[model samples]
Target: MPVDPDKARALAFPPVTVTVERGRLRMFAQVIGETDPVYVDPAAARAAGHPDLPVPPTFFFSLEMESPDPWSYLADLGVDLRRVLHGEQEFSYHAMVYAGDTVELRPRIIDVYTRKGGALEFLVKRTDIRRDDRLVAEATAVIVVRDPEVAS
Candidate 1:
C-alpha cells in the first residue's frame, strides 16, 4: 500500500517529557567512548561553566526515544518495519541541555514525499525539544520506506 502524504502531514503525536539523569549521562558517555569529563562529571561540567553534567552529542535522540511505544507512529501509518531504513538524522542546538533538566519533546511530520514512482517513500519528522517551554534543540529524522510492490 502507498503512503498517504496528506495523512502523514496531518498526523499529530503527543508530546513526551524526559528527565536527564547524571548517572545515565555518565553511563551513556562511557558507552559511547566519550572521554569528556564535562559529559560525565557534574563537577567538571560546573567547572566548565555548565550548571550540571552536559549531555553528549546525539544523546538527545535517545532522550526522545524515552517515549513509550516510540515506533507506534510508523505502525499507525501502516509502514512495514522490515522495509524501513534510517535515511538521515540531524540536530540543531539552540541551547545547552544538561543532567537534571526536564525536557519535553514535541514531534511532527514536516514533509512526506515519494520517488521512483512510489517505490521509495520519505517521511521527514521534526522534533522540537523544550525546557520550561523554551526551545532547546530541534531534531530531524528522515525515514525511508521501500515499497515491495514496486521493488519486487
Candidate 2:
C-alpha cells in the first residue's frame, strides 16, 4: 500500500522530557571515549567554568530518542514500520549539555513531501536543556524518513 500523503502530512507527535544525571553523563562520556576531567569530575567542571559535568555534543541523541516512538506514530498514519528507513540525521548545538540539567524535547513534523522514487519526511525536533528555567542549550535535529522501496 502507498503511504497516505495527506494523513502523513497531518500527523502530530507529543514531546518528551529527560533529566540529566551524573550516572548517565558518566556513561555517555565513556561511550564517546571522552577523557575530559570535566565530564566526570564535578570539581573539575566547576573549575573549568561549568556548573557540572558537561555532556558530549552527541548526547542530544539520547534526549531526542526519548520522544514518542516514530514508528508507532507513523503506523497510525497507515504507513508500515518495516517500510521506513532512517535517511539522515543532523544536529545543531547552541551550548553545552551538562549534568544536573533538565531537558524537554518537542518533536514536530516540519514538512512532508513525496518524490518520484518515494516519500520523504522531514521532522524538526527542538530540545531545550535548562537549569531552573535558564536556557542551557538549544538543539535542533533534522530527521529524514525514506520509504524502504526507494532506499534499496
Candidate 3:
C-alpha cells in the first residue's frame, strides 16, 4: 500500500516533553563542536545576557527525537521504513529556548506529495515546540518514501 495523502494529513504525533538540562546542553554543545562558552557554561551564558544555556542551532532536532517512536507511527500507517529516506529538516524560531525550560513538542503531519508518477513520495511533518503556552520554535521535516519497484 502507498501513502494516503488524506490520512497523512490527519496524522498526529504524540507530544514529547523534556526539560532542558544544563548537562545535556553542554554535551550537545561539545558533540556539535560549538566553541562558544555560552553553549556549554551557564555562567558564560549569563555573562552573554542569557538566563541559561541557550540551545545551539540544530539541537532542537535532537530534542524532537524525544518524539516517541516517530518511525513506528509511520510504520503503523503502512509506510515501509526500509524505503524511507530522510529528505530534509528545517527550523524556525519565535523565541529563545534555554536550559531548565520544560518544553512540549506537538508534532503533526502537514503535507504529502509525490513525484515520478508516485514512484517517489514525500511526507512532511512539523513539530511545534512550546513553553508555558508560548511557542519557542517550529521544526519541519521531510521524509521521502521510495517505491521499491523503481530502484535501479
Candidate 4:
C-alpha cells in the first residue's frame, strides 16, 4: 500500500498523559550512562534550582511511548513495521521537566512525502508536550518506510 499524506493529516491521535517518576528517571540516566547528579539525585537537582529530578535529554521520547499503543498510528497508516526505520528525531524545550510533573503529549502527523522515486516514504510527526496546559517542549520524528517491492 502507498502512503497517503492526506489520510495521515486527517487522522487524530489521542493525547497521552504521564507522570514523571524519579526512579524511572534515575534508571533511564543509568541506562543511558548519564552521570549528571541532577538527573539522578533530588538533592543535587534542588541545589541546581530544580524542584526534583530533571528529565535527561531525549527522555520525553520514552515518556511519549507510555501511551497505551505507541505504534498504533503506524498501523492506522497501513505501514508495515518490518519495513520501517527510524529516520530522525529531535526535541526542543521551552522549560525543564522534572519528576513528579504530569505531562501531556499531543502528537500529529505534520508532513508526509516520498523520496527515491516512491521507493521510500517519509512521515514526519510532531508532538507537543504540555505541563498544566502550558507548552514545555516539542518533539519531532521522522519515520521512513521502504516499498516492499522496490530493490534495495
Off by over 4 Å in 2: 68-70, 80-82, 119-152
Candidate 4, 1-152: lDDT as tens digits: 77889999988999999999999999998988888898888999999999999887699999999999999988998988998999999999999999999999999999999888889999999999999999999999999999977665
Question: Per-residue lDDT tens digits of candidate 3, residues 1-152?
Answer: 67988888887677899888889889888887889988988898999999999987687888877655757767867988888899999999999999888999888888899888888889998989999989989999999999877643
TM-score per candidate = 0.94, 0.71, 0.91, 0.95
Residue 66: error of model 1 in Å?
0.4
The segments of candidate 4 whose C-alpha lies over 4 angstroms from its true place after superposition are none
Q: Per model, state how many residue pairs clash.
A: 0, 0, 0, 0
In the range 5-114, model 1's lDDT, one tens digit per residue, is 88898888999999998899899989888998888888888999999998776998998889998888888899988989999999999999988999999999999999
Name the TM-score of candidate 2: 0.71
Q: lDDT of all the models against the reference? A: 0.91, 0.65, 0.86, 0.92
By lDDT, rank the candidates, best first. Answer: 4, 1, 3, 2
lDDT score at residue 37, model 3, on the 0-100 scale: 87
Off by over 4 Å in 3: none
Choose 1 or 4, whichever is better by TM-score.
4
| True-vs-predicted CA distance for residue 20, candidate 1, Å | 0.9
Residue clash pairs of candidate 4: none
The C-alpha local distance difference test score for the whole of candidate 3 amounts to 0.86
